[model samples]
Target: MMKNYITKEVLPFEGERRDLANVAREMFNRKMTNVAGGNISVKVTPDENFSYDEVIYEKGHDYLLMTPTFMSEAWYAKLNPSQILVIDLKNGKKLSGEGRLTREINMHEEAYKANPKIHVVYHSHALNCMFWATLGQDMPNLTEVTSVNVPLGKIKCLPYRTACTKELADLVYEELIKLGDKSEQNIFLLNSHGVLITDTDLHSATEVLETVEWNADIAYKQAIFKKLGIIENYQSCGNSLTI
Candidate 1:
């Protein structure tokens, strides 16, 4: 069920709300996500608006400021600050904003539970990423920028699972636990679904998403060359992508 919190006629975290909306616009403009559905969230500290004892929000210091569900189908790139919703990280209840909560809320919540340091959780239906996702293959690190920015190595493609199901969310959480802060491997490609990127901040997360998508495009071209025999044993520049 969806829950709503009174903001005492005040909207808290105005700056964060604006930033999140801006990122959503940028993502839509870049085609990182589409009307098919995707979600972005940032862990935040609540203000006085959460001071009530009746609300579940006082249970935790952190909350999730997330893009609304159906954002793409309804508003697409025109998302505004008022559309971003606040969720209580501890109880998973909608705390503020008028927008409906995303069905993938569990994906972001479980991820935060797996690693408290993860501040941003970005899921997208990028065209190239979706290509690899539909193909059910992991995205190899063909671009040097990906190798440098995503040190955790190749973008893994998890087995297929129905979207918005606990099974899918749990699977993502398990993978995150396995990674466990050992490296920068924070990207996951959901089989037949989309891409998931996590990071300590929004900028870094979005930057890595762009880099990975670019690599995915390159991988697609590489596959075409292989099948067409255009390059006759074509191989990547093998570090030529480096400066």
Candidate 2:
């Protein structure tokens, strides 16, 4: 059942679609995620043509503008605005687009429903971040930049659950609910998987992702330095050195 809803009706949020594509390219180029690693999405209120699912999408929830499935493997970084899928978040139907919706759609929906203020959900399998994920440990606040920039207190790692499953989505939803309404940002590491980020907008989400990845890189280096017994020697030398 290959479903494609190429529509003549003007797609609702053309500007948002363009931004999504551009951001996708930027992230790909930056190596924030690999070709087949992750997904991004934004919550949006649909136009008059669509109606909210009163039961599932309570409080006027509507649609999602998200990166389509296979935008990574089949399409790579060459995403176009036309490829961004418009999805009915309430009922999980394709509203308009030539591409199929991502299977992780449920993850984004649960994130949005858990907190109405969160407008973006960005997930990625960045290499440095995956280092910590592989170990199934929380990424400690490693860098001064992360401490100042990333609003989330601690980077929690969730237990491994199969990807694109309702169980995974529910797990994320429960974590988001725990963050409470006032929280502005969230970053989670899926055990032996990747990172999930939520924020008020794409800009904030991507910014936090970049900073967190950088922090992860620094964390790796810090571990190496500590193991090599460089920290104590470097500290001792710093007291006598003049520059």
Candidate 3:
């Protein structure tokens, strides 16, 4: 069941809307997500007049706003308030707004439920983690960034399920719970899918996601070097592996 804390209302964000645009830009620049590959959302508290029913209102209601489906991150960041999809949290119904919501919307909701402290959720498929996940290899606790940011915990791998299916949502929820309080550890390697990152705010979450990709990239490059035996004493790179 979905949690109750996801009430609907016009969220008064702490930063300028342009900040969100910059975040999107940076993610694309860092290669965390491609044009239409990833999604980002932030939880906002509703205003005083926002009733539960008002929060639950369907797509046609007055307050619901969302970004267009499959739009490039660059294009998505340029969206106006009217261009965003707004809906009541009580029901999946669209209260008002014309934009189409992504099927992975439930993923965001599940993250919000798992940790109310998490205000931002980022979903992406980067090269490093994707390569490791495809090989069915577990991500090692590598650098200080990975250790302090992502931490050492079980990086749950979900089976190949169709995107946006209830089955996928349930599995993600289950994996998150299995992670316990460590869910904040950033970077979940979905078997054949991608990665999910949650943070107390968007900036931190974006940073963590970027770090996960960087670590994975470094590991991939180092592995190639080791296999070739190009250089000895590669252990100095801060790999968790011991010679």
- Best TM-score goes to which candidate? 1
Candidate 2 per-residue lDDT, tens place, 8-53, comes to 2444567898899899989988999897758999887733233222
Q: Count the backbone clashes (under 3 Å) in each candidate.
A: 0, 0, 18
Candidate achieving higher lDDT, 2 or 3: 2
Candidate 2, run of 10 with poorest lDDT:
234-243
Candidate with more favorable, higher TM-score: 1 or 2: 1
User: Which window of ten consecutive residues has the lowest lDDT sum in model 1?
Assistant: 234-243
**Candidate 2 — which residues are off by over 4 angstroms?**
1-10, 46-61, 232-243
Error of 2 at 242 (Å): 28
lDDT of 1 at 149: 44
Q: Which regions of candidate 3 are displaced past 4 Å? A: 1-18, 50-67, 73-77, 96-98, 149-156, 230-243
Residue range 32-122, candidate 1, lDDT tens digits = 9888878999998655334332444442388889999888888885787878888878888887777899889988888888888899999
Q: What is the lDDT of candidate 3?
A: 0.61
The Cα local distance difference test for each model comes to 0.81, 0.78, 0.61
